[model samples]
Every structure is written in C-alpha cells, then in structure tokens.
Target: MVLQRPAAPDFVKRVFTAEEPDLVWAGDMTEIVTEEGRLYLATVIDLFSRRLLGYPMGARHDADLVVAALNMAAATRGGDVRGGIFHSDRLNSPSTRPGSSPGPAAGWASPSPWAGSARASTTPSARRSTAY
Candidate 1:
C-alpha cells in the first residue's frame, strides 16, 4: 500500500482509463546481500516504463537515504509532476526519524500517465524509515 497522505495525482483518472503505456507506475525496494552478508539496495522504478529510476546501496535503511534517491528522481525530472501516479509498497516514513533530517513533503510522481522525465516527491516518513 502506498502510504501517501496526499491524494493521487490529478492524472490518476487518465491512468485508469487505459491499460498499457499510460497506466500504473509502481515502485518498491528490495534488499541484496553480498558474500559478506551485508544488506543494501534501495530502488525506485517506473512500472509502466519498466525502468529503474534511482537507488542506493547501504548497510541499513534510513529516511535520508530514501530521500536521497527520491530527490535524485525529482531532480532527474526537474520537479515536474503535474499529472502522474506513484505506486509503492513501502510506506513513506519521516516523522519517526531522528531530528535534523529531511522534512515531510510530497515527492513528484511523473507528468500525466506516461513516465519519462518526471519526478515524485515524498510526504516524509511519519514513522521513520526502518534503519534495517
């Protein structure tokens, strides 16, 4: 369940009107362990385009780390998400993280139903992203 408090993009209606190309764009993270038994890998993807947007590898999960990747995607798209839907299984947690951290805000999520050069902001984790 995408834990975005803000309503889906205004273009969500358009996404549901079709099937391929301009439909759903889901994103989620996965953990990859190397021979050293280290946890790493946080990824964001464009489900419709089947493209990997941004990711970072580390020993644990943190709100800032997630923001870093999300920021990359936002910067990549120049912060233009007039109409788009961002689906993710993970919850966005910010309020639960330590102080002196990235604030809570909505991340851009694409422009229109298509995914190419658009961004998706975050509402900051309400419960601090797990540092796993």
Candidate 2:
C-alpha cells in the first residue's frame, strides 16, 4: 500500500526521548469514521516517535485489530522487549474487559507474556537484579 503524505510535511519531527525511545514504548487503539461513513480505521500509534506502526481498517473493530497492530510493532522490534516497558492506558473497551481473550488477566491479552505490570515483587523470574 502506498502511504500518502499530507500537504504539509515539513512540520514533522522526531519526538523520541530517553524514556520513550530507550526505556518505554506505547500503543493505543482508536477509531475514525470516514466522511462516506462506510469505513472505519482502528489505528495503533507508537508514542515514542509519534509513528503509526500499525492499523486495521475495516467496517468494524475487533480483537484482531489491536492484536495485529501489536504484532506489527513486535515484528519491527524483533519481539524482544527485555528490560523495556510497554505501556498503555487502561483498557475499558468491551473487547478488552473481563472474559475477553480467554486469558488470566482481563486487561492483558497481548502476545508478550511478561508485558503486564506485577502486583508484587514475588512474581518469579530467574533473572538477576541490579541494586541501586
């Protein structure tokens, strides 16, 4: 698919920061309706650089929409987020709440198993820690 640039492209600049570019990454899903009202686009953006990493355009939104976006980002990042943070706002959508994805956590149905936050430090991990 060919991506068209807006009339004004000179204003675009990189917004990466130490936290976002190196330590944290972000993803969020939002929908838009076309003027014809015949199409919908659910887009996922990377907050680090304001980049559109993935999007699923269709008449309606679905779980695969968000998952596909994450898949794209994962592929771009080699699916390895060791010591990195993947952050997102709370999932309040019907597709993200409880009983959604046959998973143990209601809000966490992403492909990365350790992507979610831990309630306690007791969560088992064989990796060694560095004390500050």
Candidate 3:
C-alpha cells in the first residue's frame, strides 16, 4: 500500500528573517558518509542570530532525532521556546505529522511547528550548507 504525506503548513511563506532571537527558527536533517557507516544529523538554528541552537547526530533520521535536537535547542534557551515559529522541511516523521504533537514539554504548541517543502530553495541559504 502506498501512503501519502500530509501537506505542510505555509507559516513562514518563504520569509526567512527574524528581528530578534527565538522569534524564528529552522531545522533540517542531513546524511553523512564516513568510513564506519552513515550518520544522520539534525539541526535547529535561530534565524535572527544565525546561530546553531541545537544539533544531534544519530544513526536514524526519525522523529526521535528531531526531538532531541529541538529539546537541546530549548534547553539552550533556558527551556522556554514559546512564541517561536520553528520551520523545517516536510519531514515524514511522527513529530511533524499533521495533528501530531511533539509533546507539551517540547515547548511547541500542538499540530507541530514544521513548515517548508522538500525543495532546496524552500530552505534558507545558511541551512543549505552540507558542513556540520
């Protein structure tokens, strides 16, 4: 059986700018090749400061990995990410699934805070870097 992914919300609307820190954030995952094996890296960044708020490397690119990064980001900001709009590619993970919640403690409201398309252009230039 074939399953279709839900549509992503157009919250950011291609606007990747923020006046202050924590106002806007973006996250994405990438695959890395090493002699040992492949690794997945998830990251969260602040649009205003262009600072890497959270980044976690793991063997699988799933919701857990994304959550870890987000949690780390929240911890970095003193565990309060309220009012922050986190935008990310349409990751086919439970954490980003429409109507799904990343949990209350995740600091994000229900329905998740994910946005943007899989298209590279939809992501910010800074996040396009392959380098960790």
Candidate 4:
C-alpha cells in the first residue's frame, strides 16, 4: 500500500536570530539507551533566548513525541503561537507537518533548521569554556 504524504509547510526561512522571543523555534529528536530500553527525546528550543522551551520523551521517535514537545512549548507560552516559526531538519517527518500530521497547528511555520544555531552552544558557560 502507498502512504499519502501531507502538503509541504508554508513557513519561510529568515536569518537565524530574532529580535524577540517566540519568533523562531527549533526542534530536534535524539535517542538515548537505558537499561529499560531506548528512549527518544524530542526538544524545542527558542532561538532568541536559547532556552529549552519544551521537550517530550517516549519510547519511539515518531510524530507523537515531537507533537507533544510542540504542545508543551505552545502551552508554555500560553498556547497562542500562531505567528511563530518552528524549524526542524526533518522536513518530511510527519511531526513537522500540521493538521493531519501530529505536530503543532498550521499556525506555525516550519523552515529547515538553521545550521549556525545547531552548532553553537546555547549555554553561556558552554560557549565560554575551552575545549580540550
């Protein structure tokens, strides 16, 4: 059977930093091994503050996990994140789409993740510390 794909998102990309909060957010998923099993961690970080806006963990790295993190980020900001952008590397991932997919509502813009921010340290200490 062929699986149907959702329409591409409409959000456009801009220079990485925003003048204020909520303008742009980046989402990423990582996996960790534990005695219990493999745990997937989905995270949403606010670009302006480099703050860990939201994160949700689950056994699988799927739409549900990322959506939960989006929901948490939205809820953290009072749930009115209509004009904000949510960037992610997984452009085709179901979690990056809205509506039929398991991500935030269409109100959010999904742009390809910014490379600069991805490599830079969000923590001041990490940025300042010397690397051996």
- In order of appearance, the predictions have TM-scores of 0.48, 0.49, 0.72, 0.65
Candidate 3, 14-101: lDDT as tens digits: 8888889888878888889999998988898988998998888987756666667766777788765656777787766544454453
Query: Distance from true position, residue 23, model 2, in Å?
Result: 2.7
What lDDT, from 0 to 1, does candidate 3 have? 0.63
Residues 12-72, candidate 4: write the lDDT tens digits: 3545666789877787888799999988888988889989877878876666665577667
Question: Which residue pairs come into collision in candidate 4?
Answer: none
Cα deviation in Å at residue 27, candidate 4? Answer: 0.4
At residue 42, give the lDDT of candidate 3.
86
Off by over 4 Å in 2: 1-17, 20-22, 35-47, 102-132
lDDT of 1 by residue, 35-93 (tens): 98866565655556666655656665554555545544444455543344455432333
Error of 4 at 75 (Å): 0.9
Instruction: Order the numbered candidates by TM-score, best leading.
Output: 3, 4, 2, 1
Report per-prediction Cα RMSD to one decimal: 8.8, 14.5, 8.5, 10.8
Candidate 4, residue 67: the lDDT equals 59
Q: What is the lDDT of residue 8 in candidate 3?
A: 53
Q: Which pairs clash (backbone N, Cα, C closer than 3 Å) in model 2?
A: none
lDDT of 2: 0.41
Off by over 4 Å in 3: 92-105, 110-132
